[model samples]
Target chain A: MRNELNRVVMRFPSKSINEGLARSGAAAFASQLDPTLDELGDIRTAVSEAVTNAIVHGYKDEIGEVIMTMKLFEGDEIEIVISDKGCGIPDIDQARQPLYTTGGAERSGMGFTIMESFMDSLKIKSAEGKGTTVTMRKRLNTRRYR
Target chain B: MKLIHDMKGGLLTVRLEGELDHHCAMDITARICELIDALLPPRVRLDCSKMPFTDSSGIAVVMRSARAAQGIDSRFTVAGLCAQPMKVLRAAGVDRLVEIEEEVHI
Candidate 1:
């Protein structure tokens, strides 16, 4: 792990409405790194996907606590970890596949795919009936002179 | 998010305003599907010009809307998407399912 410059930990309810709050909050915090507009959008979208997964898939039919930790490292790197203490995923491999959703018809099952594509790296850890944690990292290459 | 719909000459255009995410996806899908079923237009256009932000949930909304239109043999199109939403749609291969017209800048 690189030397951490800053960090923030947020704990919120697994309410559907908090999805927006989580993403926007992450984006706002990341703005300090002077990310480009496109980079900010990617970070926001990735955070949204991970948070949505915690709310919808992790705690299906119930409300649980969701924890999000944002860390800023040297060299404009941002690492985000979203975890839920809801029902853990049975198969992380199948769950990561594109268009493979246990979330039924309304879910596109593209959450992990989006997070993987938008971020630099994605890591998932889960144990069935225990919980799930998603960690994503991205390094923003802004041309701004420091 | 705000959804505005209008039907003209068998074509229905629904413009989405504000961020589209899991919070509002169910309502948006419901409203769009209801309009499609009620009007049964020959062509449906989802105007995403004002919708600047979205995640995978937006993809589900588009997919469900397209399915609704397809059920009635209606052509569905998504137009004027911003960069982020467009990337998501393409990432999910939704562009293959529906016609897409990116925002044009002069």
Candidate 2:
């Protein structure tokens, strides 16, 4: 199933990361299948928030790379996995709280909240010494093909 | 996305074309804010006749624009929303904040 579907992988450094690239990447990735604008927008927002989290929270002042792995599932579900090998979040629970941010100027703390609002399912895994990984899934509301 | 602004009869009309998604929110936000600040008309109308689709982020941007309009005591009206974008906007409770009109001149 994975082989039959298309995949996109990207690695971006935190210092150079911005919203435009993240939005464009998700749009171009979803454009591979020519999805509806609403669906494409949903995917783009999720990707942007994930990448922003990596750039703002995960890396902070440290230099690191944020990797994104995207896969189309059975041509109906889109799954994206974003990982960053930077300073991991100490409290995953607090980080997911809406409007909870640690950084004063550089963060809005709505990244995860926005991602969760746009995607169907969101999963996060992190360790204090390791890194943070965010996996998001959304079902494409186009015609389903078996 | 493309934006065209017109001022007539002391009303500022903004015509938007193409998809309003997360990708275009920054530009849209900036343009709308600039127009509102610069023009300060009695009524500001958003003509979405050509808008095909919009997501939550797009809706949020519109909401923010409406709030900004309110802050300056300017009337905000969203017009010519198609079925799809209208459904999404209403479901998200955006229609409650901004006046939705069926007749909008582009």
Which prediction has the highest TM-score against the true structure?
1
lDDT of 2 by residue, A1-146 (tens): 44348789987777533555666787787776667877776777677667767766788778788888888777477888999997889998999886588754324455677678778999999987678999998877673342
Q: Against the hidden true structure, what lDDT does model 1 obtain?
A: 0.92
* Chain A fold similarity by TM-score, each prediction: 0.96, 0.88
TM-score on alpha carbons, each prediction: 0.96, 0.67
Off by over 4 Å in 1: B103-106
Where does the lowest 10-residue lDDT sum fall in candidate 2 chain B?
A: B52-61
lDDT of 1 by residue, B1-106 (tens): 9999989999999999999998899999999999999999999999999999999999999999999999999999899999999999999999998889665221
Q: Which stretches of candidate 2 lie over 4 Å from their true place?
A: A1-6, A14-41, A56-64, A73-76, A86-91, A94-114, A127-131, A139-146, B1-3, B16-31, B48-60, B80-92
Please write out the lDDT profile of model 1 over residues A49-108, one tens digit for every residue.
999898889999899999999999988899999999889999999999998998866689
Chain A vs. native, model 2, TM-score: 0.88
Q: Report lDDT (CA) for all predictions.
A: 0.92, 0.76
Report per-candidate DockQ: 0.84, 0.12
- Residue B67, candidate 2: alpha-carbon lDDT: 73
